[model samples]
Target chain A: MLKFNPRNYLKVTNGAVLLRAEIEKKMDEVSKKEFKNLFLIGSGGSIAIMYPFEYIWNSTSSIPAYAEIASEFMLQSHKQFDENSVVILSSLSGTTEETVEAAQYCKERGATTIGLVGEMDTPLANIVDYPIANYAENDYAADSINLQMYMIIFRLMHNNGEFAQYEQFVSELEKMPENLISVKEQTEEKAKEFADKYKDEDYHMLIGSGTAWGRTYAYSMCVLEEMQWIRTKSVHAAEFFHGTIELVERDTSIILLKGEDATRPLAERVERFAEKYTDKLTIFDTQDYTLDGISPEFRQYFPPLVLGSLLQRVSVHLENKRNHSLDKRRYYRTVAY
Target chain B: MLKFNPRNYLKVTNGAVLLRAEIEKKMDEVSKKEFKNLFLIGSGGSIAIMYPFEYIWNSTSSIPAYAEIASEFMLQSHKQFDENSVVILSSLSGTTEETVEAAQYCKERGATTIGLVGEMDTPLANIVDYPIANYAENDYAADSINLQMYMIIFRLMHNNGEFAQYEQFVSELEKMPENLISVKEQTEEKAKEFADKYKDEDYHMLIGSGTAWGRTYAYSMCVLEEMQWIRTKSVHAAEFFHGTIELVERDTSIILLKGEDATRPLAERVERFAEKYTDKLTIFDTQDYTLDGISPEFRQYFPPLVLGSLLQRVSVHLENKRNHSLDKRRYYRTVAY
Candidate 1:
């Protein structure tokens, strides 16, 4: 890996995974209190990262879950959110202003607040009732937060009697850090080739369905646009047919992210369409990556984490090939609005 | 008004409003029956149109509401949907494949299905339990659908005791067709100027908050990308500061859909930022249009409809200025994928 530190990545991710017991204890305490619903709140990539869990929670559990952008959520006056609501908020920097404000708002409303952050003692961490902290760099924050989220979300599900296989699932999740390392190593060459081939392409469309949709959205907006300053549109695979499909010319770049889930067929439909219409279609299928010791039944839940890890490699290669620093930004936190 | 037919637009929209008596009767009947939640299902622009109502419902009522992409909803097997669910679906053609399939799926699940469509004889109209039909063209469908949605959604909210001002609100809605004509007439020159100025621009970033977000997403994907083959990324105003703001430059085209809602301040924040960084900033504020008979208390609910009507003028001019037919499509319904 060009800029990736494998040892530090494992250390951070393992630390996140090691928080399982504490996370489970916290969730159990919250579960003992009768909560009505779950509000997954964050901003930008953090909010995108929650979408998969919202999808999973909606499909697998009777509890309703909403993934909302923090600032909008605060202003919307969501009627479903009340004293009994449970809120899960994530901020990698632990200093995202809107996220910190949302945490305080949730706390003031007497909602049980859970914060996922990259460091302790930060504003968000300080305000939230249950703060899960792990040290991670910008490159590895996704892996760390995702690892913690699995423990937190599934534990809540398990406590709710919705998931009976939580123990087995977490055991498989325990193997993910090493498996994800393999994913990076396996994807590095293809990522480099994709970067080299599309370095000069001005625009791209990224499509994903089910759990991979968040990664598709975040990678396009957060990495490609924000980091490399490239133009991109991320559409859901199911939505590609509605309006976006008409934009698919033979030379247009289309990226499809295929995950192992019930909505896999939606991505396949896009694949079939893109194959017929476009010459520059790239498919990143999680099924192609072998998670050596993971169970087949659990593969569906790993796409968000897998795709996040793999896309980091793509981001690194894109930055290297385009000679654009991933940290470069014209307005975000650099200039006041 | 370029290619707009005023009499037909009024006739179609008034017919939708005429359905108010029958729609209220149907909603009253359903209100007597017990339902758990709302599933607003559609595809493409149809799905995008449902988002505002979902936001409104979530903010105003305790009953949960979900705006789901039709195909993805069918595949996700959402646990919230069941016999107790009230499903609202819209398809102008009444034969959009995914929407039809979703209606069938909902019907099979024993959910109460409501279909809004252009004609009464199509598959969706035939399949749904309550079919509300009105004649509308591609350009005017937004107006027609939005008028009926106001009736249906507000009736539901009123029945839930969440909105006590339904009578006043619908009275104001009854005035919308003529008022929207004023909106189109008022916005024609500005729309033409915008189309002329941005005709050569290859890409644009559309931003909106609250109710306007749906219009932002739909106009960018449906009209600009699908109809004119221009590239666009429609981001929420609050989310703009998070990642996409980094893409803004002096020449970057930024279209802000400003609506008078609780989330208006979020859009204002984006405006402050975009004005500082981008010279090509376009703000379409619903407040600019005057609804002659509408009450001040009801202005918050008109943005979706007002913005829709105003943006239709923009679409007409964009098509004329770009020398592209809105109906022209290389893949959509022209050939098999």
Candidate 2:
């Protein structure tokens, strides 16, 4: 477990889990209001994190949800966004220019705004109507934000009468901090092996579907390209056959983030194809890990959290094996654009 | 212009324009009916083509529009898609398996389904409630599909009382074929230069925003990766700063698709950054072309069409300069997955 701190991870994740009461109260208030639609806005990893919730909300609830990039959302002048709309935005630093500006934009439009941040009293937190803060480092922020999102979003769905199993789901979620630690422990060895094996691989294709798609996208752009400086293409399983599948060669690295959702079959299709075409196919299926005290029915909702925790292990190993600082950046925040 | 076919382009684009009367008749019926939302469903390039319309719809109309991948849409069982949903699908060959299945899925749910195809009696055309066919070759397919999309989508917005200048817009659209020809003619030399310059580049970063985003994604994946076996990372200009920008270096090839839209500033920001960071920066701005008979006020809506026509020239030059056939594929339709 290179650079891994289990105790700190638990502390950050527990902090997020402990926000359940406050998140519940805020979600209850917003859910009681009549909103036409929900806009989930953020930048980069933040926006990628919202994709799973958007997919979940669209599939399970009558309320429509849109996951939009903060800058694009600000400029689009979306006709669907109005006073009756609810906007949820996140920025771990709470100082991300685009997210903060988007929060201000939503406030000006008289929409209900919720902010998720790693610290309190930041620009984003100050502008949002409901600001939920938790302390977490970069390695554990995904687990923290995702944990809080599960509490807020599912509660909203419960209030909408779309999810009757909320109590059971949250009960299972409460056990995740401990279970996710075990997931990291189990994945550590494999992550190390993967990093050791593919440290110098120039390009890779990461494919996923359903809830896992966000993790696939974020891990490629935010981690592989941005963190490790490795080239990668993150394509949805359904989109693989369309164009990207043609890029597959015998030695091409293909990483499949498989989760237990309705779209699992789509990922399986890609796995079948990749197995035939490439020798460097890697499948990170959440089904291989057993979360103690979690129901099988709830596994569908656990991919984002589970995959996040597992990938954190992979990130640490990649940094160790590649001898590249995960925090190193060539231009981002280094120079003014 | 290399590989240019003016007569065939006019015939295909005019066919789409001719469909306006029938498209209006069908859209009038759908608009008169009570509908909850619009679902723009397709696979790969089909879904990519729907993105601009989705953006336009969200910006101009109160009606919420979703652009969903066909296979994932079927599996997700999106709650936003119901009997009151107007589902639009396209499959050029009218035989994309996922798209046909999606049309069936929507039909079984009693949703209004519209299919745009190259043939009238194919599976997708036969299954959809309203099928609009306009024969086109690969080079002109984008033009044909985008032309019909402008007509149908704008008419839908007009019916929703969101577009007051639909007549003038359509009139301008009628002049697009000839104007688009001029765009190709003007861009021919630059396209050839770009192809000759970057024909051997292993990878490229294609950045675009707003209406040009879809073209960026499609060109990178569908043309570069699939057709030329050249790796590419197509990122939205807004999202470029988030993660992908870190990958840009002095010799890194960056293609900027600049379109006139609310998000034009986002592209400009990327342009400024790439100018300073990379010497291999190529800009294909629709503003460079004088679209005769098109009002300045209407130029914003023409980027997708204009970019599509302009890129067709790039495709022809790339094929010629690289000595690679655009239709040749290693996997796509060449082998069974």
Candidate 3:
């Protein structure tokens, strides 16, 4: 597990999961407000993490949800967003310039904002109406924020009478920190082979559908491009047929992150096509792991988290094989834009 | 212009404009229904074309709108869509497999469907409740559908009392066909220079914001990648700051599609950053054209159409300079998936 520590992963994830009671309490309190819709706002990986919840809300709940990029959200003046809207914003550093500005903008409009941050008293934490803090660094932040948001979003659904199985769902989510370790161990060999085989591959296509699409997007941008300076195109499985399919060559790497949602068939369609066209197809299906305590119906909702955890293993392996520091940056935060 | 006919452009666009009176009548009849939200469903370029209206609905109208990939939307069972939802589906051929299937799926759900197609008797046109027909080829379909959609969407807004300037806006839109020819004539030199300069380039970064984002995405995927076999990354201007900015180098080609919307500043920010990092920055600003008979306030809403018309000039040049036929397809519709 190149440069990995299981104990720290468990502790940080558990810290996020352990906030269930507090999250539920806050949701119960906020449920009394006349909020009409939910706005999930962030930037980069933080915003990408919100895409699955947006999908969940749209497919399973009657409530409307918008997952918007923070900088664009500010000037767009979304007509559905108002004083009665509930905005969920996340920034691990609590100092992402655009995210903090968005929080202040929402607060100025009298919207109730919930902040998920790495520590208390940061600008985002201070500006939001409800701040939930947990300590996690760059590598662990996506996993951590994802764990917290599941509680916050589902609790809102539960309070709204849209989800009756919240209690059981949270219990399964609580067991994830333990199960995630098994996923990493299981992925180690394949991940190592991938890192070694494609160390110098110039381009890769990462595809996914439903809940897995967010992680596919986040991994390509936040991890591959930002962390290792690798070039990648992350397309939704359905979108793959549009224009990207023509670019596939026999040796082109097509990585599919398959989830167990209703949209799995979409990814399956890509799998069937990719299997015929490219020999370098790699699939990381959530169904491969039983996920010990998670129920069959519930596993569909957890692929983003599962994919996120498994991809961390790939990132570590790539870092070692490519001799690239995941922390190295050519321009981001190196100088002001 | 190479391989372009101005008279046919005006005729095709004027035919779409002629539908305004009829489109308004249909909108009036449908507005009487108990629909609650909008479902914009399409595939590939058609779906990419819907992005701007989604932004328009969110920013300018209070009604909820969901723009989804036709194939994925059929499988996801979006809870927001029901008998009371209004769906808009478009396909140039009107036989696009996924789009036709999506129309059938929405029909089964009893949602009101409006189909914009190249002809009136195609499967999609037959499936939808309201079929708007215009004779348009691949090169002219985007412009035609955009003109028709402006009538359809704003009529809904006008009927909902959200837009009081509908009369003024539509009058300006009616004048677009002739004005569009002017844009083509104006863009000819620059478009040729761009196509000549970038004909041998392997990749491009197409950036846009607000109403112009859809054209940026469509040109990158539908024209550059699919039509010319060139690779491109179509990123929103705001999202560019998050991860894609790190990929910019002195030689990187950054093409910005600047629209006149509230999000213009966001694009400006990217322009500032790209100007500093890339020697190759191509900007297509809607403001460059003085659209006669159009009010200042109404011009902001027409960037998608303006950019669409302007990009046609670029596409024609690319086809000639790159020696690739725009009508040639390597996989799409040529073989079974």
Interface RMSD of each: 0.8, 0.8, 1.2
True contacts kept of each: 0.87, 0.84, 0.66
B21-120 per-residue lDDT for model 2 (tens digits): 9999999988988687999988778888988889988888888999999989999999988899999998889998888999999999999999999999
Assess every candidate by TM-score.
Answer: 0.99, 0.99, 0.98
- The alpha-carbon lDDT assigned to residue A301 of candidate 3 equals 92
Which digits, one per residue and each the tens of the lDDT, describe model 1 over residues A1-337? 7998999999999989999889988999999987989999988899999999999999998989999999999999999999999999988889988899999999999999999988899999999999989998878888899999999999999999999999999988999999999999999999999999999998999999999999999988888888888889999998887788888889999999999999999999999989988899999999999997899999999999999999899989999999999998887667667
Model 2 chain A: weakest 10-residue lDDT segment is: A1-10
Model 3: per-residue Cα lDDT over B1-337, one tens digit each:
7778988888899999999888998999889995799999887788878999999988888888989988778778888899999999998788988888999999999999999989988998999999989998767888899999999999999899999999989988999999888988899999999999999988888999889988888888878878887877788888887787777889999899999999999899999998888999999999999888888988888898889988989988988998998878878887678
Q: Which runs in model 2 stand beyond 4 Å of their true positions?
A: none
Error of 1 at A275 (Å): 1.5
Accuracy of chain B in candidate 1 (TM-score)? 0.99
lDDT of each: 0.91, 0.91, 0.89
